[model samples]
Target chain A: MKIAFYIFSSLVFVALQTTIFRELTFIGVAPQICLVLVVVAGMLSGKEWGAICGAGMGLLYDIVSGRIVGLNAILFMYIGFFVGVLCKGFFKHKRIVVLFFTAAAELTYSILYYFFAFFIWGQMNIIYVFSKIIVPELLYTTVVAVPIYVLMEKINDYIERKTF
Target chain B: MRYIFEHKIAVLIISLTIVFLVFMASYTSDKARANLGKDGLSTMVLPFQIVFTSVTHNVQDFFAHFGDLEAAGKRIEELETQVAVLENNSRELEDTKLENERLSSLVGIKDSLKSNDSIAAQIIAKDVSNWYTVFTINKGSGDGIADKQAVITTKGLVGYVSEVGAKWAKVTTIINDGTAVGGLVVRTQDVAIVEGEFELQKDLLCKMTYISKGANIVTGDSIETSGLGGIYPKGILIGIIRDVKPETQTVSQNAIIEPAVNFEKVSEVLVLK
Candidate 1:
């Protein structure tokens, strides 16, 4: 059932990202839902489940994006692993960690993305991309972290009812 | 070896290595990327994109029309005051178009154009990442849509087809990175190349480069497709010049543009066949 729920939310979030969220942009930036799921799931479900959910969702997201496959999956797996370890046991009912995890995820993704994608593509404007894309997108994603974290907490609780 | 597999960190590293290898393979192989879209997943999900886009579009339109009615009320009052002058100006403009065509004949450039064949396509999805601008449409080869065909809304030029599937296609807009559209400043008749830059797209703006030094382009001047590129039709509205950027002084000038089409609200487009 947890696996089934994961698949269902993955599809729903991907659909939301490509449609309504496009219009729900702030400062010309939209929240990265896949990244949000990674951070939130890690905080809620602990190391193993969070990493598993992140990998599954990330792969689906990569396919929907139609870009380099598994790029997001790798980032998400590590993000889920680290966040899951960082807040493994003490994270229950702690919502503020959502903001911290999201910030860390955003910063990491931005730097790695700028390095691997933009710089490798011959765009040597790191400072420009850092200031313009990274900062603004971080703020955008952080603002969305609260609502997503709250929702994922409920889903996590539902999944936790049946013991492993 | 058994203990290594039992360690969580070891398992994580193994997963990371596998995904990274797949990523590298897909990055290096064009066939891998093609297989992604052409494979079974996209076909199964295509119907959901259509349905979700339709529902969202309707809800958006419902709210949009409310705003439009309010704006329309104000326009009605303003137009009532200016209706007389606008009627006189319209008559004079029609008369000038006729004389302008006659003069254009001597220059070997016909300012006339016939209607283009087109098909209406519903927007199915927006780009997953905001870093790039790409969208999916419901019509494709079945509707005679092909790569590089221009997509436009009633307001003006939107984008062109970058990729096509049997029943779906991807349209990369001018606001997307690396896209370019040749533009003409209506006020001065000066031609310029409009290109998308990441810095400018942050503000939902594009950069119109290669502006002639002698051209008298000002802020708010309407820019239209120059038709120099055969991809988009001639004289389709591209945008309005917003401001001049002082960078790149060694070459021609560059100006910021606010595209005529409101991309966020665009639900459907007519694709030139």
Candidate 2:
């Protein structure tokens, strides 16, 4: 049942990432719905499942972006592992943490992605991509994080309680 | 970690799936692009397009009503003032027109340089962000705007059609990073590659790269397409050179060029020579 929910959430995340969130972009910032979901899932689930979900989400993102394959997968896996470890230690179902996790995960993803793109992909102009792309995006995604986190918490709690 | 090592199989499966998808996507990209060609999507998108157009028009009308009323009042006042001004300026205009006609004749110009083979197109939508200065124009393949066709206004070059749908075409502007055009400094007669930089800015500008290092260039020098690439015509005005930054230990110089056309103020454009 949780697996089914995961698949459904995954599809919804991809669609929203491509269509709706894709439209909600500022100058250097764009909402990454997939990254948020992966982070939230990481917080909810343990490390292994979080990593798995992140890998799957990142794979989907790479497919959709149509530029630079495999980069997102690598980044998200690390993000999930790190964020999950952080959450596993001493975090409750707090809104601010969830928001922070989401923003941090996205920032980490962008940083790694661009770094790889520059070094591996041979892209010129090694500018500070994160400071521009991630910082503004962090604020935008943080503003959007509260409601999503609340909803995710409810869903996560419901799943844990009901499935058990 | 113990958890990750324990779920090695799941990790492997995830990694394999990604690799497989990437391989499939890379292998099928050309075929997919061919299959999902503009024509294929147009047929699918037509119905939705109509609905979107109608909804947008209705919403625009609804929102524009109050603004239109305010504008109408202002316009009436302006029109009255303009009428008096026009009446006063009529004699002056006639005199000016005579002088302009004489000067134009002396310049040895044909009365009509541009034939009626032009299409007027309105920008339907800009891309999600200004990251790519790509816009969808109302006219498309149906209206004879083919791929690689230049889009221009009375002012100068707007962009060229990169992709064409049935009723819409994506005009990738000169400011888009992926674009490059061979341009000439009209004043110096030196060729350079006009390419877009990553940084987006208010002034519609492009970076002119690969200029001959010793070429005489100055700010305010007119730049135009050299027609070396055969994509654009010989002398479509691109921009004025804002700054010339000569390459260090390289045989090229880069110049900042302010685009001749203001993309923001653009409403209609001509897709032609």
Candidate 3:
């Protein structure tokens, strides 16, 4: 049941990200809802679930919207794993913690993505990319992550109650 | 062995990452790699994208019409004055058209794009990544659209189809870092390569490079496709120069171009067959 739910939700999120959310840009950057989902899944469950959810979402996104295959898959998987492992002992329900982790994950993802996609391709303008793209996206994704986390928490609670 | 047993998830994650890294490496190195996964995924998602895109457009049009009502009177007044001006200009244009037709027959000049077949397609979605300026259109190989085909709007050049599936195609726009087109300056007749840069994409602009050092190119100069590359037909308007940067130590002089098509508002395009 959990697997089915995750797969269904991932499909919906990927659809939204590519179509509606693609138009909903704040300062030319869309909120990374899939990233938020991975972070929330990690925080709610554990490393294994987080990594699984991340890989699933990343693979869906890459197959659907990404130009290069498996790029987002690897980035998202590690983000999920690290967030899960690091936030293990913390009060996972805290909004501030979710926000912080989302921001950190977004930053890490953006930097790593930039390094692979642009930096090695001779686009050596980190300052400009940071100012123009990364920061705005980070703030936007972080702010958007809160509501997504809340919603996911509700779903997780419902699933847990049903399971046990 | 104890540490590995204790951190099984970490090891698993590392192994998966390495596997994906290999996939990425192979995918990049081989352009002709099997795209069964991509094609299957795209085909499945294309219907939902079309539905969502249509709904969004309808909603936008609804609000846009409501807004238009408030400005309708003012717009009518302005349009009335413009109509009168356009009427006079149309008469002059008719004479010019007749003269051009006569001169063209004498010169044996041929119209390029008008002679080719074209398919109209609606844009279903923009690229999900913030780094690239790509968009997916509803038409694809099934509709006679293919990779590297020129895409345009009534205004002018949009870009070219970079990838195609059965029912959808991805277009890499002129502002994307991956696109390059042969451009000719109409005023100076100077030919150069127009290319998209990562930084310039933020402003919906591109750069025309490889101009001769002594070439007299300036701001506001019109640029069109040069027909140097067979991909884009000759004489389609590409853009107008917005700024000219002088030659520097490591780079040649280049002019920034404001593309003829406004990508932000473009919803439908024609794919030249």
Compute the lDDT for candidate 3.
0.86
Cα RMSD, each candidate = 4.0, 7.0, 2.7
Better candidate number, 1 or 2, judged by lDDT: 1
The 0-to-1 C-alpha lDDT of every candidate, in the order given, reads 0.79, 0.68, 0.86
Error of 2 at A48 (Å): 7.4
Relative to the real complex, the DockQ score for model 3 comes to 0.68
Query: What does the i-RMS of model 2 come to?
Result: 6.7
Docking class of 2: incorrect
DockQ of candidate 2 relative to the true structure: 0.18
Report DockQ per prediction, comma-separated.
0.48, 0.18, 0.68
2 or 3: which has the higher TM-score?
A: 3
The fraction of reference interface contacts (C-alpha pairs within 8 A across chains A and B) present in each candidate is 0.41, 0.00, 0.67
Q: What is the C-alpha local distance difference test score of candidate 1?
A: 0.79
lDDT of 3 by residue, B1-273 (tens): 998899888788888888888878777632422277778877777777788888888888988998899799999999999999999999999999999889998999887866889999999988877888888888877888877899999999999988888788888898999689999999889889999988999889998898888888888999999988889999999999999988776445888999999888899999999
Tens-place lDDT digits, model 1, residues A87-144:
8656355777788789999889878877776788888877878776788889888879
